[model samples]
Target: MALLARRVRPDDWKPIGVDALEANAMKVVVSTDNRSVIAGPGAGKTELLAQRAAYLLQTGMAPPPRRILAISFKRDAATNLAARVRQRCHRSHAGRLDSMTFDAFAKGLVDRFGQALPERWRPRPDYELMFPNDTAFRGFLFQDVGTPPKAIGSYADLQAISIKTFERSLLVGSPLPVMGWPDPTVGQWAADRFWQSSLHEGKKTFLSFSMIGRLAELLLRVNPIAREALRLTYSHLFMDEFQDTTQIQYDLVRTIFLGTDAVITAVGDNKQQIMRWAMAMDDPFSAFDADFSGKRTPLYNNYRSSPELVRIQHVLAQALDARAVEPVSKTAATIAGESCAIWDFSSPEIEAQRLARFVAAEMKAHALGPRDFVLLVRQKAVDYAAVLEPAFRAAGIPLRNEAGTVGAVMLQELLAEEASELLVKVLRLAMTKRAGRHWTECQEALGALRGISPEDEAAQAIFARELDAEATQLSADHPEPPASKADARTIVDDVLGFVGRERLIAVHPAYAQGGWFEKVVEAAAVHLHGSSAGAADWTEALDTYEGLYAIPLMTIHKSKGLEYHSVIFVGLDDGAWWSFAGDQVEATAGFFVAFTRAKQRVVFTYCAKRGARTKIATLYGLLSKAGVQTIQIA
Candidate 1:
């Protein structure tokens, strides 16, 4: 059924939840020209995109059957942007916004139009997505003899055959010169070989996200019909976190929408380009301008951070780029005392213990919960977890290492995955005692899963009754919350049995591919086992599962686009941030990102015993210049 368009007057359309947009923001939002919005941290990038989407939809710029496509780097960011637009616009208008991550978008293209791909590049209908390690690549490159090919110089040369190498060579359909490779030809040959091996498994095909992207790009390029169809379907495009876009992704966007009438609005801060290691374009903003002839607009309002914190962030930002403009803070300090501080400790153990104690005391003093605080590291959050987790446990504070892996998946990624979300939602529904928004949402989801329409009140009523009976049975079977790993597994099984795994897979077809549903369930159970400890009861345990009552520990990369009342940066010495010396620009940008995540307080800890401070002396000096206090703990 085609959706009916709701036309709204341009004069009548207004920003939701705000009086009016900033002058520059308003121009960007209403402008029909392709635009590059370079915004610093806390500049309301996502909100601006959401508002712009609402503006376009409400004004009937993208009418019925013509949709707006919004692409974000992260799944959560995509979901948030879609949710905001849904809240601001009418149901029919909001339905036209297709918000998805770059990976998901590319995969969708491949999934729908894969048959258009040449046989050599085509994947099976049920291809398994694989994230191969360096070791696997090395084995594939130099099978068994432990001898390097003439093209491969040494072990160091093998490092050149990374995902970026594939993106540039195999994905782009030709070999491009790679920085560290001996020859582009050799790199292309290796990438092609890897792809062939990945896709040709007997009775089974394997594909990586990069492979899927390449296939998608190929499908669009080779099949003019598919390309034209996409161009005609979307009249407006939104690119969130544009600075992190990779070369292949940029090319994919150009392949589909470059010559079309679609207006592309890219929003990002170059200072937050932390994905360079993953082959993000070096000068994405300039490339976007050159390719799309985009009008550049810079936003200066800091809506997420306090004034003091914003000031501190500017100091670091200026250190990264001498000409950087300071963003004005729209928020005032709500918490009293120092907004930025540096803690110096003599040893790692002392640092961990003192930091734990400090967080515990601060939570009690400020009447804050575990969610109010977060710990950020430069990289390798698991290593930091090994040091900090015990101390936090000793302090009776639960610390969740979001960057750590559950099974083969990262904890944060697993929690955000569809299967995991489904399990959590079902568990929450089962434990519900009263009817409210949560219950209503859960019932709606269940009804949708069962193919029952909301318009059919009689069908909905019957399904709701059956759902209630199932929930009752689940509750009776497990009267108490999960107390152990076994209990968690049992609860998962019970929930799956109650809902019927087959029905869930039928509703969410993606779950049927690659055993993804089972894998997520396994990961969720493992995570529940570790996180449910010390939980008072079912509700408390569920709270922990839902990322409540626990401090979040993640890398600075993972901490992007998120905020907390207070942030603690651990292991600021050279050893933890070894890459800082080689790429100070990105490191400083990352530090700026971490600094801006705190609304009221930012704490930096340096342990003398962990590593020498010689490499990060400049960082320490920058903090000093920012007027941040240095507290030496005895």
Candidate 2:
């Protein structure tokens, strides 16, 4: 069967690529039962996505009553595609294209069918949705689950697994238990209660991110009218970055559109699915054969990287897993011929400094700016703030750390000051009577304020040397001269008012963008048991705001779906890249994703000795076996 556009002529559409694979994939969009395009890095997947939207619109395949919906993993990605469709497609046909992220689409469904939602999740006047940060979630989990194991000290892992299990159970309509729990019944009970409590705590009602996908899937599965309305609402669905799709996300799509007239186009490269930590499975199309019986297309010609770099990527991928059989031929021009190397260093700090100097020199030689280079890490460890930041500044290199974890961690460090701890204590005492923390938490903050640790006494002597005698005497060890609620409010107002006017707001102009003030308010809210409010504010400050234009230093996960002219990947040691778990397949996949992000040059850096041994990193050995030549710097 040949697919044809309904209302537009052949001249109206522009060719996406000259390659036969890309053209065949586009035509299979309408002619086949369903299509799954496995596109590699720089394989023009974005162009194919845009052209497919234009084709469906131009062909009249998606009329006004039956619109086409395009969903992506990130908001910026969806916005980019929407912009492309508007510019490339005809003005009249562009209106039928609905482009948004999965979360946005789920929110729309919830708003449309509020009554059909589960009773626990039905919409209310004061209902608010919140995607809480790690700090807030950990605080809430501590309160619910009590103090965690001393060895663990945090229930973040448990909370994450519970949430994943909770959402998946809602999708499949079965009570699936989280593994490793001693008693599944008790674990399930606590998870259910936590889920309910997270929705409504006191007068504030906050919605978690997982609930959106779960409830939307539930509504579509249970409500006949809602199902039919959705089935008739969209004619075709195009999902990009399908490899990063989670189980709940996949289940939701399958629940809503299966056995319907919707044409689905799921496009992603299996090798690039590096979000396994977030519960994204290996096979994105695992259910396609059973559900849609889709036809699979692979695009092997990479139009993004140089030929030299492309060969290296192939070796890295194959070293991980030979079954990962998507070899790509480079179709892009080489900017700097064969600019790839592996640098060796004795210490991590020296390695960072050398990277900055190298980047500065590269910019001068290649006519590039700071933005043209990227320094990538496997994880955002303490060195990102301690070593990399100062190293770049010392070299007069304009660099910005794009990893939000670093910003959040730095904020916590700033708040750890003695003067800041006093302000937090005052806030905790003031909020005690309302929606605030427990009395024990208030007492703990007061103790830290009254009796500073031996490590903090030096900073306290400088910042809060002139403390009130009355406040200093009210320590957790000795609670004396108790103050009333009015006194506490006055103390909070005085302390915060003083810090806001004197310390935080009066920071040097150069350091104002460091988010000191935001962190102060957030730390106060967290200590005072108003973390919900703090979570919203802190998340907005980190996620909503963009850093200055400079070289981006981020983790490999953050660098996914993004490319640069020059890339440097540091920390290739065994513990950082390949753990003791012996999962080289997953490790190599991460390296492959990192290597493919460079358009021209790539540099790998590793320390020869982690602590004492002079053993090289296992990744270096793997690459050597793969026949990769490294210009090592001793």
Candidate 3:
């Protein structure tokens, strides 16, 4: 009868973390302690979280705990694991469970603690044509600070933006960041006011983490009742992506859950700290000993990628460690999969598109389809649409990546500009019968661009801005615009609210039709009757179900604890490309992360002009140690 029982809970069955698992038995002194998980790429940190939570649930303890608190970087991830746990555990055994992203989790706490903080306008605004996102936020950060000292851009741009924004808020005492203020026009006085606010005794010292930390701290430390409840409610707190946490975030988490006896586990990959832009704070796992003043455990096994890939990945990450100037840990990882290779392209324009051509050619020769292929890129810096995507569409092949939404947004940005051009052309074409027909065709081509993404704030904004002009022109020439911008926003926002639910609730909205995507696309089609061509551009950009993809185009920052059959790290150039971190010894550790992502083959390509001072050189160093070949672009 005993032999018939399950050897391990399905939730506890993590093949990945088990491979990279480190028996830091000596490090974790307290039976109940904070376990700082340090590992290389695709090490399966998320999988380990499930395993540990499962162990806590199955055994329940000498006296079983009532619930398990699992936190993650993304709600999508948390929702996935929560559903999996529920499926794995029979109804009777699994305790009450709760999972949340740090943002959602913090918001939940705010409900209890921040009731009195003047949130009159904070009760979830009814957004009409609410904008979803803007590239200005991401691309603007790489902004040039301009001219003499005052005009220059640097990492300080982030700080400067914050300080400037705050000063504007303070000077006018405006409750919110001014909506229409572009960088140059944003109130300079506001920046000074923001700077002064930072000088307040209890205010944050550092600009990077000032907002997130200060907000969380305000509730925890200031609200007496809320503080007491936090201590009791989350006795055993589990935090994922601990590496990206800022100092104030660390302090807030540390302050709430009191006592060393309560178990706290922080799982993170320190080598993957590529968020200099987000002011991502660093917490050394070695310090867990003194901070928790307790035990530390290492989950060394990496079950995500192939062993061959992990070997190279480990070397890459080791090279990044500015601390340990030593060699790769002889402890081989157990990742299993095909090897990785990176080939170079002579033409950036033809690369993604030509890569598409290569893939289509491969598919035709090999009898493959879109399902069997994937395209991964580092920075979607330039508008490569004319390069790769249009090529794929011309071939009638589908592809998925962050490119989908970005492409849609890019099209949306062009709606206004394109419409003005098409209108003038049509008017002129109208004067000339033959040319008028072409102008009419151009108008129809302009209208098809839409956001398959439900809450595409960028597209919605651009569409709304140009809707009036398009409507007036259509009344005089073509049929009236399909729907007014306000109505379109109402319908689209409603639809997106549901689609966003999938992102927010994880698994809740299986039945919401079109979710957010249906509405956004519908809005695009409705808004532009003559512009089916534009619609095609927008529809072509939406990529759903990318998880099934094998290949990935990833940022060095996003590649943490993840691996692939092959990896191609692009956009490597000079001018602050290889700045070593604080710990000189730990510098190469980060390189180990990039190296270990490749299992069997490791190939790197960069602008040769960047020369010896590039990440590729560091790759050369690590590969030489592991006997991996370092080849240049053929």
Ten-residue stretch with the least lDDT total in model 1: 173-182
Candidate 3, number of clashes: 92
> Higher TM-score: candidate 2 or 3?
2
- lDDT tens readout by residue for model 1, 1-634: 2222457688876777667777889988888899999899888888899889888887887776799999999988987897787667655577678888998888878778887677777788778777665566656766722334675555446555564344444534432222213454555556655666677745788876766766777788888999999998999999999999987788789889987899999999988888886768888999999989999999989888999888878888888778889888998888778888888898888888998998899999889998899999988888889988999989989888999888877888887776677667776777766536556756755665576755577987888888778777877887777677788888788777766788876544446567778888888888777666876666777787777878999998898899998999998889987878888878887888888888889999888778988888889899989888889999
Query: Candidate 1 regions off by >4 Å?
Result: 1-7, 144-184, 201-203, 443-470, 483-487, 493-512, 529-536
lDDT of 1 at 203: 74
The top-ranked prediction according to TM-score is: 1
Between the candidate structures 2 and 3, which one is better when assessed by lDDT? 2
Candidate 2: regions farther than 4 A off: 1-7, 10-12, 16-23, 28-32, 118-125, 130-187, 200-202, 332-338, 390-396, 405-549, 578-584, 609-618, 630-634
What is candidate 3's local distance difference test score? 0.43
Q: List the residue pairs that clash in candidate 2.
A: 5-59, 6-59
Q: Candidate 3: which stretches are off by over 4 Å? A: 1-31, 62-65, 91-95, 116-212, 284-287, 322-342, 349-354, 357-376, 381-385, 390-397, 401-554, 558-563, 571-603, 606-616, 623-634
